[model samples]
Target: MFWEALGSAVLGLALAWAAVRRLPHRLPARAMVLPTGAAGALFGAFLTHSALGSAGLPVILVGALAVSAASLSLLLRPAEGLRRRSATA
Candidate 1:
């Protein structure tokens, strides 16, 4: 269990770091993104483990990645100079 958690966290941090590098303009500060990704992965692992207590580590890791990516995506913003078109069209 410990190894599974550690792996998930590492994966999540790596994913966040990659996002921070690739989408610097869309994502928020590193300070926020880093932790959000980690926490999200932890939460995902917990949830997945609870739901499938005997599931394999790979499954849990997949869950962690999916949730982490989703959480990170929440922090994204529209590209520069793009205004809201749906609200005032």
Candidate 2:
């Protein structure tokens, strides 16, 4: 269980990093998803797979729903933005 949690955490962070890197340059900052979502999704997936996998429809449905909601929510957050000033330091 310890290893599983660690793996999930690593996976989540990696996914977020990948998304940030892969996001297109032309997209508005707000349109990009945050990496934390990826991490949360990973942790949620591990939980669902640990013991709840055998549970009935309700369990599966709930897990799936939660994961989807978290993952999508992260993706929906506005990407970070950068601004430029006319004057130099």
Candidate 3:
């Protein structure tokens, strides 16, 4: 459990770092994406752990693959710029 928690934390940090790097230049560091990515990763880890409790390695592997594929699909979707703030004087 200790190692799993440690690994999850590290993974979360890594994802957060990646997100921060990909943010647009106009965005402020204080409002950057690291926190969002980190939170998502931690939540995903917790959910995955809960769902796979006492499961065998093969089942765990399949579940991970499914989750990862879904996440990748969502991430790769084209951004509609829905979150962009319009310029206002």
Candidate 4:
């Protein structure tokens, strides 16, 4: 369980770091992104573990990655001029 948690955290942080590096303009500040990723992964691990009951390490990691990516994706900023204008306006 300990190793699973540690691995999940590391994977999440790495995912966040890669996203920041790849899309610095799209993501919010590191302060918010880093924690979101970690928390998301941790929550994902717990959730998966509860649902699947230690199915396997790879499966748990996959679940963690999926949730972490989703959480980070929420922090992404939309491109300029991409907002849909009100049709009635």
Worst 10 residues of 1 by lDDT: 80-89
TM-scores for every candidate against the unseen true structure = 0.90, 0.44, 0.48, 0.91
lDDT tens digits, residue span 60-89, model 4: 999999999999999999977687889997
Model 2, 53: alpha-carbon shift in Å?
6.4
| Residue-level error in angstroms, candidate 2, position 55 | 11
How much lDDT does each candidate structure score?
0.92, 0.53, 0.49, 0.90
lDDT per residue for candidate 2 within 1-89, as digits (tens), equals 45444555555555555555676453235234444544475557566877665555345435544664467454543545755456764
Which pairs of residues collide in candidate 3?
Answer: none
Question: Residue by residue across 1-89, what tens digits does model 1's lDDT show?
Answer: 99878988998899999999999999989999999999989988988999999699999999999999999999999997886579757
- Ordered by TM-score, highest first, the candidates read 4, 1, 3, 2
Between candidates 2 and 3, name the one with more favorable lDDT: 2
* Per-residue lDDT of 45 in model 2: 59
Task: Tell me, by lDDT, which candidate is best.
Answer: 1
Candidate 3 lDDT over residue span 1-89, tens digit each: 45444555555556556544664443346243444444455555556678877554444434443443344334433455656666982
lDDT of 1 at 52: 94
Cα RMSD of all models vs. native, in order, equals: 1.7, 9.1, 6.9, 1.2
Ordered from best to worst lDDT, the candidate numbers read: 1, 4, 2, 3
lDDT of 4 at 82: 83
Better of 1 and 2 by TM-score: 1
